[model samples]
Target: MELQQMRYVVAVAETSNFTRAAEQCQVVQSALSHQIARLERELGAKLFERTSRRVRLTSAGEAFLPAARQALDAAERARAEVAAAAGEIRGRLAIGAIPTVVAVDLPAELKQFHLRHREVRISLRSGGSEELIERVQQGTLDVAFLGLPLGVRPKGVHGRELARGDLVAIVAPGHPLADREHVDLHQLSDEPFVDFPPRTAARAQTDEAFAAAGARREVAFEVTTVDFMARLIRQGLGVGMLPAAFVPDVPDLPVLRLRDAPARMEHLIWSRFPPSPAAAAFLSGLGISAA
Candidate 1:
């Protein structure tokens, strides 16, 4: 019934381990467990089935989860609103971004925002475009930086395009195409490629571009991190295509301009609803109205 108890429950549900939840909540495991146990006693329902190996929510816990989240959200919003009325912006801002983000100097912006709003806490997570958008829409992320194929705007969220640029091919120094100033997709069709996993937004851009250009290429290495992809390219395992702006991150790789390449659009997206005061202030600083 208490907000603290609900918070413990929510944390436990999310982490699925009492120890981990306690760590996340910044409390001792015994205290968190005692609080949750007391809350369950008051409700006359067992909230979780705990074993040494795993912990899972019971039916009652599952049913109570949504209302608990709503209550916590409402309480946090009320607190933030009161703080804002007192001429202070105080809240947590969760931001998500793709690894290839280059449209905005994220670290610089975050440092500036922190200096301006010392009372606000900020956290950042990296994810794919779709996952970041979903987190924003779910209110878990206050804002997100997404990279999607050109002409593909984020659905069910408010987004402002920051920049658009074509992808460039990168090859090892000893590769045959490394000396070329520029090449078309068809010209590199024979080269094995290193790219993101299939079905991801990042991979779709390259896949669609190749299909449109009537070029068939093999993706011999599929990796998650850009660093790994860059390493593979450097070893001559496969050719990699990345945004021109991002090429600087993987230095020493020979970059070849692609005459026919997929264009990526970088965007800042947020929930459609009115943003928290902290988020609004941050957006306003960037000249974006988070209305």
Candidate 2:
């Protein structure tokens, strides 16, 4: 029933190893085990099934995990609120971003934010736009930089457009269409393409554009990172369509604007509920209106 016991249980469940969980909790393994055992006795149910090889959560533990997390989250939020009332900003801000969002200079912005609010902690995670948006809506992420297709908005979240640009085609110097200043979608329909996997914003935008143009492309390779895509293009594996900013600037690689391509939009997305003070300060620093 004690808060510390709840933390111990959650930690053990997350790590699935008593030794590692005790290490993370900064407690002796025996002490941590004793506290969890005491908690289990109080609850009249075992939380975890301990085996020599691995620790698995019991049904009771599985049922209690979400409530335990919520209790910890609420406690932290209360502490943050008290800190805010005292004119201090100190809390963890979990931010998510899509890979191509490098155009926004996030590291520099986060550095300035950190300098200004040294007590505040920032955690960044990278994922596809869909996954990032889901995390934000689920309250796991404070904010996310998402690459959204035009006119597509995630439900249960508020978004502010940060940047907008068109998707471009990138090719190696020796490629047949490398010299073209502008290429239409249909022109690359039959070309082998190195593309982002489905469910990513870039892939969705590319598919929509090609569908609109009545074109179908052959995807030879699927990659999640823009850097890998750039490498693939440089190796002449296949052509790629990505946000103009994501295409690397190489002497032999050429990026051409796609004719009639849909514009790619980057938005800072957050839950519709009020954000923590630290998250608000970050949004303010970035000149994004959290309202």
Candidate 3:
């Protein structure tokens, strides 16, 4: 019923433990529990199923969670708008990015944003481009950086292309093609490769390239991180393809230009709805007019 009660409910649902939720909310367990009970009574539904060991959300809680979060977000945005009108930014900025983001220097940008708006809180998260886009659409993230195969664009969100480039092959020092200045997909297809998980956008770029070339590549290692993929290549476990921007991360490995390569498009995305003041300021700092 009350905003404070909704906040307590959200914290409890997220932590799944009353005591931990109380600690997170900076209140005593008894007070937090009492407030939640009062809210449940007003709603005529039990929000949680508490046991001696674990606390689980009841069906009613599951149904109410999304709206509660949206309400809280709305309240926060209203306060932030008022502050912004007074020439101050005061709200949380939630940003999401793919792990291999190279289009912008995130750390430097965040530093500048913090210096400009000391009252704003910033949070960053890493995930797949598709996943990041979903989070932005759901209002969980105010903005996101994404990378996808060329010719593909993000849906259900406002986005713009930042950069696009071809991928290059990486090989170990003593490998057969290590000395080659350039190679085609067919030439690298026969070699064992290390790549991101199957069906991921990063992996799809390589997969689609090889398929178009009528070549088959055996994936010897399925890795989630660029560092691990580089390590596997350095050890001669397999060859890999990555955007040219990422080559500096594995400078020791030999990089070969792919004559027929998949191109990756990097983009900046945000919710179609108007962004929070913090998000708008961050975008303005980047010279992007926030929609």
Candidate 4:
């Protein structure tokens, strides 16, 4: 009913605990409970279902959550615009990144952005591209630098391609296949492959690479996390197919070229909303690409 009510709803939804949400709002739990009850009453719908152990959003809550968050975002963006007009930029920003970007390349860029925008506080979250995408859609992130090109969706966000890399075979340095200039998929068809789990966008690309090459890559193991796959590769359990940037040592395992495999493109993505002056200036300095 009120902006304050929506703010409280968002806080509760995020923390999933009345006590924690109250703490975040710096208010008493009783007041939060009372306000939330009032909000539900005004809406004539049950927003959340509470139990002794947990609080979960009802369907109504799920529908209302994004709208509420977007309303808050619009207000905040307006405030930021006003502040920028007065020559100041200050706000909290949540950013998301996938494993490859988080481990291989984003540190330097993030450091540079931070140094240049001392007033813009940034909170970074790391997950698989899928999780990052949902967060971006849910307004939990102001921006995200995530992906493996084909592994994302057309959402209400903007994206800029950062770089493209081949899906390189990752092996241990002493692996026998390291001597070759280009180890094609046929050479390692019998070798166990550590891979992204099936049904993922990256997996689709990886599958296409093997299918088009007519190479039957054996699934020695499948994992959701890049770290797990890397460890398996190091242990010689399997060879992983990963973006070139993710595996710095091609010689470790065999650096195989998947014939006609889709090039993985890492990108810098953000909500479509106008950025704060600090974000805008930093983006200009970084020169994020749309390709």
Tell me the tens digit of each residue's lDDT in model 2 across 1-291: 888999999999999999999999999999999999999999999999988899989999999898998888788888988999999999889999988785579889899989988988889998899999889988889999988889887778998887788888888877888778988988888889998888777788888888888888898999988788889989988988777776664445788887787688888888899999888889888877687
Taking every candidate in turn, the Cα RMSD to the unseen true structure, in Å, is 1.6, 1.8, 1.5, 3.6
Question: C-alpha displacement of 217 in model 2, angstroms?
Answer: 1.1
Quote each prediction's TM-score. 0.94, 0.94, 0.95, 0.81
Give the Å shift of residue 33 in candidate 1: 2.0
Candidate order (lDDT): 1, 3, 2, 4
The runs of at least 3 residues in candidate 4 whose Cα sits more than 4 Å from the true structure, single-residue gaps closed, are 102-104, 130-140, 147-157, 173-181, 249-262, 271-273, 288-291
lDDT of 1 by residue, 62-134 (tens): 9999899879987987898899999999878889999999999999999999999999989999988888988
Per candidate, the number of residue pairs that clash is: 0, 0, 0, 5
Q: Which TM-score value belongs to model 4?
A: 0.81
Off by over 4 Å in 3: none
Error of 3 at 254 (Å): 1.8
- Native RMSD of candidate 3 (Å): 1.5
Residue 203 local lDDT, model 1: 97
- Report the lDDT of model 1 for residue 97: 91
TM-score ranking of the models: 3, 1, 2, 4
Per-residue lDDT of 1-291 in model 4, one digit per residue for the tens? 777788899999999999999999999999988998999998999889999999989999999998998788778778777877888776666878776673335577768877866777778887767677777666677677766655544477787767777777777667787566677777878888888777666677777777878878778687877778877888878877787666563334556665564567777777676665655765666665322
How far off is residue 176 in model 4, in Å? Answer: 4.5
